[model samples]
Target: MNAAQIHPLARSPLQSGIGASEPDPDAIVASGVHVIDVETRALQALRPRIGAAFVAACRRMLECRGRVVCTGMGKSGHIARKVAATLASTGTPSFYVHPGEASHGDLGMITDIDVVLALSNSGETEELLTIVPVLKRQGTALIAMTGRPESTLATLADLHLDVSVPEEACPLGLAPTSSTTAALVMGDALAIALLDARGFTSEDFARSHPAGSLGRRLLLHIADIMHSGDGIPRVGADATLSEALVEMSRKRLGMTAVVDDDDRLLGVFTDGDLRRALDEGTDDVRTTPVLASMGRNPKTIGADKLAIEAAHLMEEFKINALIVVDAQQRVVGALNIHDLLRARVV
Candidate 1:
């Protein structure tokens, strides 16, 4: 890999503080690149011969009504687990089933509606074949991924996806490296193809992953956990600063919504404002109206937006809170960084 060439505007040996004894940058980059070269060679090896077989594999997964049961042995098992996760996180519902365990009665996990994605570089794994007959009897479709097109696993599969590589990236030729990476990428390709075919939106992905940041971004709606009704700390803009401070403390959101008589969002008065006001050496409870210290035009977001969008907006503006407003600019609810954190949006 070539190192990024420095531009004339940014080039200067003085910018580099490395001592003269430091190793040559070319050798340093090449040392790391040699490993990448091996992996690249393997992926390049998969690019060819991906004709009808890849299409068959995708069709098998697309026709699947039940979850995709991924099974494999050894390092292939590790790769299978990741493929299963990718499938599940995308559109396809999937879970990893250990082949060894499947032989020990876990084969019961395979249902008639499910589709099997079996992995084995050699196209043969004794533990995997043990349950193959049962899967066949149960009417479950099988999709095989292997380096050998003529192997038993491929022969038994309803659809065979050839993931052959000329050689392993491992120096010993014993470890599974490039082959496994190819399998992983192939699995990802299948998953994304299915995701696109099914019109799997990020919102759908978030529903499947309600615990992750993606889930928070997609599944969360303002109406689901917004500070609404009376829990919303709100006060009229003409209210005294003392009144606003009481509302902020009582609401415990570190901020108070400053609204007009018609509930239109006039501005916002947060703890930061209070601090700044007090630091200006004014008495904490002087006759200053809440409107006097509030932001004239506060940033706002819609209630239906993904929480990730809200976080991005807040981050870009260097603000901590955002008021949820309607089409008419009426304040419906409000939230801050901590709310997003608690909701796992961050």
Candidate 2:
């Protein structure tokens, strides 16, 4: 572009601090503060505008049997993509389709049962306007978000959400700043509103994000990771301490459950208990009964509890392992801190 086309704020290489004096720190801070203040005001202005039109837009999306197709051009397109992701992850099915691509056959991705949410700061984005006629013919619902209520795109929309901003944060008044922030915040409001209306819970959100930390905490149960069957270290209450140590070594869980003939848990014999016995010098491992050194009423968890709950219990008690018991207090499984770490639940 020529010099006339260049933005007033654009600086040539030589003017951009190549061996030039350092910029004033106070000026830089003031500029940042001004930008934040402008965006904050934009959001404040957007709040009251979420009335009838916003409600109608949300209603259209919620009733959509297909999906919410978000479309826009330029910087507005970036906001549309993010809004689409937020809507999708928060329970509403949505996706972003670039306006330019929509005009080039990507519009086929949209169906009549779907709602199209189009964004344009000026409400005159050519690419978005070009596809409106086709969308209209297809009987698709249109929700327009723009700064100008009188613009052609707004006039054609079934619902118009006014995102008018008082002023842009950019000093040059050419770049999208406060306008984009208003659009993004408005999108979030719609998504979260629909999320609540749909009774979307954290577990529902976790189902969509199974690979994330929140998913691991909410969906991973103790039974999913606990070692059951032969993996559980256990010995009869009548067994010697030496036999208990052998079970603990073979299972490698740092502990063995002392059980009765019916396999009902009596107590747990851990490495810590053995160390305490050695320090006290009271009994020999080869001759002493496992019950003598075992800790009674040890911390136990149900196999159905969330893995995160186990972590909390372990941290609260300062223990490294826990015996998994069933509803009848029978030893069913075992797990350690390392198992939780391996599952990335901690």
Candidate 3:
């Protein structure tokens, strides 16, 4: 069909003139739909093929008392890096090794304590095979992800994860598109399985990624962000409203805890309190005790509670801060939304 008439294969079905030249909209739509179909088939085919071999691979890597050494070449090398990252961030310790570099001096990095996961679509990457014999001699467990089961890499591996497809999604049957995606997803499956097998928690994940946002959400304790000891904006119930405001300013937490003579949390007075008090002509009334203007039973969380919970309190109450207290109801610390922001949980 002509571009004007439009067919499924036509490059431009609706040629329009805004001010100038016409464009081929049909061809773009056809090419895009074709690409989506190809990718969807590649992904859907993995369902039935995820057999016992995947589980065995996970068990091998989980039982491996050492690191996971991921090796591959070209596009596979990029996927290898992601696999290594997923392994490390989950429960297993893993690192990527270029197949070419392993042939030179990097092969020394592998040991019997490690497990090797090699990726090659053809299963015949020469650099990868060059070191297989040495690894076998060292007794390192080997896992292969390849399309060709009869290929050399598959024959040498202790566990073979068949990532084969009838053909690659590449229209010409040449590019590595579909195979690489399948191998990468399989690597993710292995990483997550090992993570579950190890009972890896978010806390464990955060420990490994201490600089990431999850680390701050899970690891930054109340004590990490709380204003402690003299830095806490606290004043006695007998103190005047003006005195509490001074304390709030000095601590910069926007509120002051009103406590009993024994340092027990009695209530909290904030700038909001100051405004309310002034509306009743208490601004000039310095004689009013801070407790008289305080919010009795102000929201509180434990010093041991997660900072994420603290962020939640601030969001739920539509306030900026909260009191940190011990089991005895003694004010131990304080934190504001800004603290959570600095910690990256906000």
Candidate 4:
């Protein structure tokens, strides 16, 4: 992927930075503040309007045996797509269907048990009205999200949700700014209400997003990623420094776990320890027992813990490798920073 391009005005106004041309910083800041204020007011106006209709919409969706079909035109269409995705990811099954497509053969995708959520800021979108009668004929339930409750779509709908905003954030009041935001927020409210009703859990979310980082954190355990059996670099506590160096080199983990005769962890020897030993003028390291030169009380993690927790432990201790031990404190596995990187859990 290409590196992100920095915004020209990211720096403070007082800074003498190079740019195409200097803009009025006060005007820029004021414009952003004005937009935010307008949207905030719009959302505030909507809070009091949420009542029976909103609750009814959520109830219908919770009881829906089939999927929730979201349909809209233009800007409302974009928000409708996002609403559908959020609903699907949470717990409810949903998908976006373009209003224009319903006029052709796509209307067949709707079923009798489905709930149709139609969005149109004006409440008079021609494409949606053209097929509303057909969907009604199929005995499908209709939920209208529009600014005008008296419009044809809203009057015909079994439930009407008012996403009306006081005004657009645009100076000329032509673009769909505050209105679109209001509609998006209303969609989120509905999705979350349904999510809570269904008792959705994080594990369920991870199942839907198995390729995402959340899935790795929830499903991947230390045993799944750690180097096990013969892959672990280890040496007996009585082994010579030369023997430990040979084990570390062969395993390529940059460290070796020092264990006793019963395979219990005792200490650890690393390349850093080797350097420290040399600086101490221990020239006889070749024959010296590794226990005398190893670092005592090395950090270790249980093999049953989550991989992400192991990652946090490594980061907190500023170490690149961790020894995985069983309940008996016997070395069962080993892992390095590169292993977490390869697993994409880092």
Candidate 5:
């Protein structure tokens, strides 16, 4: 078959303009590089523009008796929402309110004590413009983030933050490309500056994100999820395999901590060890002492350690369970993979 017949789906099956040649791989990569370079330059240019107005915006947020109400339209609205989230998580109380929604009685959410941060690339978005008068009537402070400092919104605002970029990264220069990036970066700068001024600690961040993985790492302690006292499945070192197996089966943790008479863990015996024993052709498995079959110096974690640290220990050692020890290295509790999963720390 000819090449045209074999590749009927080819762009230029007929060698006409019906299908143009494929875009060059280098050109595709260069296009992305160009966009990034443009956005990088835009952010660099914005650095010099950070002056008194930006500091005043942060001071207003810090002084507000109410929340920071961030409102915007279109792509600017998306950036507004992210900015609000960053602010809220970094010790500043903030939330996003769609400008269109604000015109329809949602405006009540903004009070005199609140500071309204309005975002618009052109500073002339009709939805944002419609609510500016109402915000003024309510005696609420206004902060404007826009590419046009001379626009009506900027003129009406108590503080105007100039976010003008050299040009849009979009080839047509119509899409909100570098402009939106500039706004987002400025929002992040404000949030981080406020974070530093407020002395936001990691613990404060964990509280704001209590359901996230970082929260689990920072807030969940081993003691919070471990099985203590009677809940632990422990067998004496001198106990027979049958007794240890019974303990494991009763606890259903797939393993048993082998301990001494003083309740100090001596070692551990798991299903894997049992399998190894059976493969070694040991006769009368029930008669074997747990001490003879147990693994010596098994890995353990302290009760005061983070549960995520315990998870890392389990993964690094390729084990399913760990004995929880006190500061003195005496076993006080026990936990397994299921415990970590239940605590949402895995």
Candidate 6:
């Protein structure tokens, strides 16, 4: 087949308006720098606009009994979706509804107690306007983020947040570049303000993100991951150093807790203690009592303490293992650095 028949729509570099030459690295860098500078100025202009209207929007969301329903069209829709996710992940309860979809049947997702945050660069998106009447009839509060103050969407809103940018970062001045960034930043500001108002803590954040690394670090307790019962390496205070070594090897914890007759933690014998004992030319391991070589006043953690706390204790003292104790200081469990590593709590 001829070249044209084989590739029906393919064009030469010149036909594609890209000259048959490599692009200039310096020119590409300059374009990127210009875009960043434009977007930076847009964010700076948006800062002062966050006064009364911004605070009012925050108050409406903070007092909302239902979710903050974010809706927009085109690029604004993308920003709205991200804003919804941010709000949900923070302290505020929120979700996104497409304005175009809302015009169909997604409007049912909104309720009278909800606060709708609508975004439009020109404040004149037809899809958003089509649902405004229904939202009003239902008594849902409206918050508009727009570039034009007098436009239909802005004027229709109970409160307006102006995300107007001086110009677009796009060289053609036709793309939603700086405008989208401004809207996203405004949404973040609202979510974080509500987060602070609700006194959201890291633990609360962890509860919502249990599958993430931060959740494992913050929510995992010693009782959840520590080796307990037969899994814990332990020996009586009267056990020989050789017996303690055998217990440590069998449990593979690199250490063994030294317990009293009633199973109360007396001390711990670890690889480090063994090294010190050998370096000091202590008595034979088969005959010497483990108590003579065990570390006294060893660090211990409660079963209810966070796993990350155990990691901190290990690091603070340069120790690799910890004894888990009950309220009466009885040895209930044991864990080492490897335990935290396996659970990814470290």
Among these predictions, the greatest lDDT belongs to: 2
- In model 5, the runs with Cα more than 4 Å from the true position are 1-27, 228-231, 260-262, 271-288, 292-296, 316-318, 326-331, 341-344
Q: Per-residue CA lDDT of candidate 3, range 181-240, in tens?
A: 888888988888888889999999899888888898889888888889888899987899
Question: Which residue segments of model 1 deviate by more than 4 Å?
Answer: 1-34, 245-255, 260-262, 269-296, 326-330
* Rank ordering of all candidates by lDDT, starting from the highest: 2, 6, 4, 5, 3, 1
CA lDDT, candidate 3, residue 179: 84
Total clashing pairs for each candidate: 0, 0, 3, 0, 0, 0
Whole-structure CA lDDT of model 2 = 0.92
TM-score-based ranking, best first?
Answer: 2, 6, 3, 4, 5, 1
Task: Give TM-scores for every candidate, taking all chains together and pairing residue i with residue i.
Answer: 0.77, 0.94, 0.91, 0.87, 0.82, 0.92
RMSD to the hidden true structure, all candidates: 8.3, 4.0, 3.8, 7.3, 6.7, 6.6
Deviation from native of the Cα of residue 49 in model 2, angstroms: 0.8
**Top TM-score: which candidate number?**
2
Which residue pairs collide in model 3, if any?
Answer: 11-26, 11-27, 12-26
Clash total of candidate 6: 0
lDDT of all predictions, in order shown? 0.83, 0.92, 0.85, 0.90, 0.89, 0.91
Task: Report lDDT (Cα) of residue 299, candidate 1.
Answer: 86
**lDDT (tens digit, per residue) of candidate 2 on 57-150:** 8889989999999999999999999999999999999999999988888989999999999999999999999999999999999999999999
State the displacement of the C-alpha of residue 147, model 5, in Å, after optimal TM-score superposition.
1.3
lDDT per residue (tens digit) for residues 36-93 in model 1? 7778988987888567888877887888889899989999999999999999889888
lDDT of 4 at 98: 94
Q: Which residue pairs come into collision in candidate 2?
A: none
Stretches off by above 4 angstroms in model 6 are: 1-20
In model 2, which regions exceed 4 Å deviation? Answer: 1-19
TM-score for model 3? 0.91
* Weakest 10 consecutive residues of candidate 5 by summed lDDT: 4-13
